[model samples]
Target: MRKIQLGTTDTMITDYCLGTMTWGNQTPEADAHRQMDMALAAGINIVDTAEMYPVNPVRAETVGNTETILGNWNRANPARRGDYILATKITGKNAAFVRMGEDITAASFTAALDASLARLGTEYIDIYQMHWPNRGSYHFRQNWGYDPSAQVKSVTLAHMEEILDAADRMIKAGKMRYFALSNDTVWGVAQWMRLSEERGLPRVISLQNEYSLLCRLYDTDFAELAVNEQLTLLAYSPLAAGLLTGKYQNGAIPEGSRMAGNGDLGGRKSPRVFDAVAAYLDLAQKHGIDPVHMALAFTVQRPFPVSTIFGATTSAQLTRILDGLDVTLSGDILDEIDAIHRAHPLPY
Candidate 1:
C-alpha cells in the first residue's frame, strides 16, 4: 500500500482505509478480528469505525458494540496499536439512541470524545470526526429534502467555533490528534477552515463524505475546495452500497446483503440505479476488469487527494476487492466511463 500525507499533519494513512460498519451485527466478532488481521497484513493501516456502528439497523442495543470489538483487537494486539491509524466518529443529531438525540455542542463534543476513548480502550484518537453536522447535511441521499434557507449563519458559525474550541482542548489534553467532518458541505468545511485559521485553533484534516462513480456530488464543489485547502477526502461507500458489484441486479437481493437488511440502501435503490450500475458493470466486463476494482480505483485515481474507505461483511468479499488492487483504468475505459456518466448522470 502507498502512504499519503494526511492533510498538513505528519500522520500518513494508506491509500485505502478498512471500514468496520458491520462488525457486531452481520459480521461476527471472530470474523471481524480476522478481517482486521487480514487488512493489516495487506498493509491497510487506517481503520474507520464509529460509536453507532454495526449499523445495518442502528439498533439501540447494538450501539457501541463495534468499538468494543475494535477495542478487543487492540487489547489483544497491544504491541500493534501503532500499526494502524484509527478514525472514529461521534453520532450527530436525530440519533435519539445516541446522547438522547443531542446536537453537537461543546459539552456534547467533550462527552462524546470521552465516551469514544473509553469504548475504544484508548487514550488517544488519531482522527475524531463528527458523524454529521448539527445543522443537518444534504448527503446520505437526502438531497431531495435540502433547504439551506432553514439554517442561520450565526448559529452555524457559533457551533463551529465552539466545537473547534472543544477540539483544541482535547488536542491539548492528548485525547485526540485531529478533527474531521463527515457528510458535510463545502460551505461547512470552508467555515471550519476559516474559523480555525482566525482563532489559531486545531484545524480539520479530512472530510469523510460519500464519493463514488454513482455519486459524483463531490467531483465539482468538493473537488475545488479539497485541492485549494488540502482537505483529504476519505471516500466512503465507493461501491455505491454494493450496486457496482452487480449483486443486487435483476431485482434479486442476496440473503445477507446490506439492501436485504436496510432495503433501499438509504435511498440508493431507485429504479435508475440498476440502469447506471448495469452500464458500469458492462464496461468492467468488456475490459476484463472487476467491478469492485474499477469502482474503487476510479476514486483513487481522481485528480485530487482521496482514500477510499471500503467495508466487507465477509472475508471472501474482502479478498475479492483486495485481489484486484493492481487494476487501473485505461484512458479508453475512463473515456467510456465518462460517456456513461454523461448518459446516465444523476441516475439515482
Candidate 2:
C-alpha cells in the first residue's frame, strides 16, 4: 500500500483506508478485529468509521456499535492505537437515532465528540468529520429533489463558527486532532475553509464524498476546489457500496450481502445501476482484470483523491479489495471506462 500526505497535516495515511461501517452490523466483532489485524499487517495505516456506523440496518439499538468494537480492539491492543490513523464522523441530519435529530451545532459537536472518544476508548481521535452538511446533500440518492435554497446564510455561518469554536476547544482538550467534512458540496467546503481561516480554528483536512467510476461528480468543480484549497478527498463509497464488485450483477442479490441486509442498498438499487455495473465489469474483463481491482484502482488514480475508503462484511472481500492496491489501469482501459461513462452517465 502506498502512503500519501493527508492534506497539509504531518500524518501520512495509506491510499486505501480500511472502512468499519459493517463492524457491528453485517460483520461480527471478532471478524472486525480480524480484519483490523489483517489491514494493519498489510501496511494500511488508516481506519475509517462513524459514530452511527454498522449501518446496513442503522437501528437505534445498534448505533455506535462499530466504534465500540474498535474501542474494544484499542483497549486490548493499547500500543497499536498510535500505529494507525483513525477517522470517524459525527452524524448529520436524517439520523433521528443520533442526538435526537439535532443539527451539528456547537453543543451537538462537543457532545458527539465526547461520546465518540469514550466509545472508542481513546484520548484523542486522529480525524473527526461532520457526517454531512446541516442542510441536505445530493448524495445518497437524493439528487432528484435536492434543494439548498431553504438554508439561511446567516444561520449557516453562525453554525460554522460555533462548530469551529467547538473544534478548537476539542483540540485544546486533546480529544481530536483535526476536523473534516463528508457529503459536502463546493460551497459548503468553502464556508468551512473560510470559517477556519477567519476564526483561526482547525481547518478541514479532507472531504469524504461519494466518488466512483459510476459517479464522477467530484471530477468537476470539487476537484478544482480540492486542488487549490489543499483539501484532500477521503472518498467514501469507492465501490458504490459494493455495486461495482460485480456480485450484484443481473439482479442477483446474494444472501448475507449488503443488498440483502438493506434491499435498496442506501438507495443505490436503480434498474440503471445494474447496467452501469455491467459496463464496468465488462471493461475489466476485456482487459483481463478483476472488476474489484479495476474499480478501486480507478478511484485511487483520481487526481485529487487522498484515500479511497473501502469496507467488507467478510475477510474474503477485504482480501480481494486489498489485492488491487498495486493494480494500475492502462491508458486503453481508462479510455474504455471513459467510453462507458459517456454512454451511461449518472445511472444512479
Candidate 3:
C-alpha cells in the first residue's frame, strides 16, 4: 500500500482506505476489529466510517455502532492510534434518526462532531465529512431524475459559511484535523473553497464520492476540480458494489452476499450492468488478472490523486481486496479498459 500526500495537508495516507460501513450490520464487532487489524498490517493507513453506518439495513438501533466498534479498537490499541488516519461522516437530510433530520447548521455541526468523537472515543478525527449536500445531490443512482432548481444560492452560501465557521472552531479546538465533503457537486465544492479562502475556515481536503469503471461520474468536471484544487478523491465502491468481482456473474448471487440482501445492489442490477460486468470480467480473464484487482487498480490510475475506499462484510472479501492492492495495470490493459468504457458507458 503506497502512501500519498493528503491534499495540501502534511499528513500522508494510504492509497487504499478501509471502509467500515458493514461493521455493525453484516459484520460482527470481532470480525470488524480483525479486518481493521488486517488492513493496518497490510499498510492501509486510512479507516473511514460514518455516524449512520452498517447500511445493509441501517436500522436506528445500529446507527453509531460502527464508530463505536472502531472506538473500542482504538481504546484497546491506544499506542497504535496514530498509525492510521480515521475519517467519518455526519449524516445529511432524510436521516430523521440523526438530530431530527436537521440540515447541517452551526449547532447541528458542533453537536454532530461531538457525538462522532464520543462514539469513536477519539479526541479528534483526521477527516470529518458532510455525508451529502443538504440541498440534495445527483448521486445514488438519482442522476437521471436529479434536480437542484429549488435550491437558493444565497441560502446555500450562508449555510456554507455557518458550517465552515463551526468547522474552523472544531479545528482550532483540536476536534478535527480536516473537513471534507461527500455526494457533492462541483458548484458545492467551489463554494466551500471560496468561502474557506475568504472566511479563514477549514478548506476541504477531500471528497468521498462513488467512482468506478461502472461509474464515471467523477471523471470529467470533478476530476478537473480535484486536480486543480489539490483535493483528494476518496473514491468509494470502486468495485461497483461487487459487480466487478464477478461473484454475481451468470445470475449467481452467493448467499450472504450484498446482492442477496439488496437485490438491486443499490440500483446497479440492471441488464446493462450485467453486460458491462461481463465485458470487464472477460477483459480480466484475457489479461490473466483477477477482475477485482483490475477494477481496483483502474481506480487508482485515474487522472487525479485518489484513495479508493473499499469495504467487506467478511474477512475473505477483505483478503481478496488486499491481495489486489499491489496489482498495477499496464498501458495495454488501460487502453483496453478505456475501450470497454466507451462501449458500455454508464450501463446502470
Per-residue CA lDDT of model 2 for 148-177, tens digit only, reads: 889899998888888889999999999999
Q: How do the residues 44-95 of candidate 3 rate in per-residue lDDT, one tens digit apiece? A: 9999999999888778888999999999999999888899999999999989
* Residue pairs clashing, model 1: none
Q: Which consecutive 10 residues in model 3 have the weakest lDDT in total? A: 54-63
Q: lDDT of candidate 1 vs native?
A: 0.92
Instruction: Please identify model 3 stretches exceeding 4 Å from their true place.
Output: none
Candidate 2 residue-wise lDDT at 273: 86
Model 1, span 1-348: residue lDDT tens: 777889878888888999999999999999999999999999899999999998999999999999999999898888998999999999999899988998889998999889888888888999999999999989987798798888999999998999999999999999999999999999999999999999999998999999899999999989999888889999999999899999999999999999999989989899898999999999999999889999998988888889899999999899998887667889899899999999998777
**Candidate 3, residue 91: lDDT:** 95
How accurate locally is residue 88 in candidate 3, as Cα lDDT from 0 to 100?
A: 96
What are the lDDT scores of the predictions, listed in order?
0.92, 0.89, 0.92
TM-score winner, 1 or 2: 1
lDDT of model number 3: 0.92
The deviation in Å at residue 125 for candidate 3 is: 0.6
Candidate ranking (lDDT, best to worst) = 3, 1, 2
